[model samples]
Target: MSLKRSLNRALAATTGLQVRKAPRPSAPPPPPAAPVYHEPAAEDRLLRRPVFVISSIRSGSTLLRMMLDTHSRLRAPHELHISRLEVGYGSSVSEYAMQNLGLERGDLEHLLWDRVLHRELVRSGKDFIVEKTPGNVFCHERIRDSWPDARFLVLLRHPESIARSWHESDPAKRPYEKAVTDVLRHVEAVDRARETLDDACTVRYEDITADPGRELRRLCRFLGLDYEPGMVDYGRKGDPELKRGLGDWRANIRTGTVQPGRALPGSGEVHPALLPYCDSWGYTS
Candidate 1:
């Protein structure tokens, strides 16, 4: 029939070669789209303008939380890990039912988080609530979506000190080398939140320990609250027991008074993995 087909048949006959069609390559499946979340209005959430402390592990957030809890109007709680709370549909019919009501999995989870925090605040009889979960830095965007009127407090510490403290917290379980890597991940997330959150107020562990009154005053101005003297003597109040799993469970925190932090690590003493972040955070000499 076709000239090329006839030539191929003649060549096949002469050389005993078989002609076979090559399989067509298939294009790869498209990547799954990222989930888009729309921010709910303030009235839809149980709590509005709640405060979140965004920080890396071993960054003195617990100390800050303890101080905030002493305030008359603020109630600071332990790490709730609300972002890890997820919702799932048990069946397709249930998923369709939820979809019909314009509720997604994230939306339901947001409502649950709001209710839990509101209950905590109501129980304490406090006007404002502060949540200081170190892991929340990773889900800061999700939190922003969940509470459009939320306020953020960015807490930073010397990256090298964070790595050392993390390793020292459990030397057997956390090797120094592994600690550096893990600490850096959190530091990067903090940087991202600081860059993106418009209402974020930043404070450093060093500043809080150096002159807590001054730092607390600055934070009060940002939070629109009056500085209470009790906040300075949080340890004397016997509130917010320093526990291991919830936060720093160390002798320094047990002292109650804001003790001066260990001297900043010298530039040469800083770990190689943490040097870049140290430079960015102004920890270098």
Candidate 2:
């Protein structure tokens, strides 16, 4: 073979050897840059204020829940009876017996309540969780200890209206004696809660119903939330879950009942029997 031909043969062999070698697997496309989620900061979570509605039964707490639930950021649960059973007494008898037995401190704070609430909110991806637990009025201190940043809304109705409504609903089930006892208990609870919680505010049912929009706006301002006009006519809304059981007291009351006409049953004031307790809370008659 000629020298030039030999050189050409050598070049061909080198090219063939290079072609036989395995190709470097294309650099595995840079493992997808770890997903960067712009999640809310811890400070943001701490800043969130959970609104708790505390009141006695038949005091239009449902109305307040309906109103607040209309806000896009708020999630008001039906009635999470957390306070009385979890943090304080189980019932009137239990409460009375505990007092008689000199039961002072309650059980340790349970995470079950918070876990359930957090789970529900997480599943729904809701920001605000409003718990409308009527029985919580007695456990304000426990609540404060649990959620220092929580905002409380106390719903007030005329004792007469509350008692009358209770009687009308199931007179056989709720006798006048029970109704009066509940009112008295509620008054005492409210008084104690007021003294303990400076962040608490009370809303009268009459004021709420008479001018719902105004009251809702005021409530939003108090809670540091933006008021939504939709909250005003929550009963008239399309969402059935939001609309149920609101303002139903109107239908339940009997004709010529002492409660139907006035904001409160007598003189638009707290009952004379409950006056001292109301005064303790700085509540005006």
| C-alpha local distance difference test of each model | 0.86, 0.63
lDDT of 2 by residue, 143-227 (tens): 6655657789877776667767666777888787677676787766766676677667878887776777788888898877888
TM-score of each: 0.85, 0.63
lDDT of 2: 0.63
- Estimate, for each residue in 1-285, the C-alpha lDDT of model 1 and write its tens digit: 977688789989999775667889999999845444456866778896899999999999989998999999999987888887767779999988987877777777888889999999999999999999898999898888888788999999999999999999889999999999899899999988888986799999999999999999999999999999779778743335656677876777777788788898874888887787887877775
Best by TM-score: 1
For model 2, the superposed segments whose C-alpha errors exceed 4 Å read 1-48, 84-109, 235-263, 267-272, 275-285
* Model 1, runs deviating above 4 Å: 1-36, 236-240
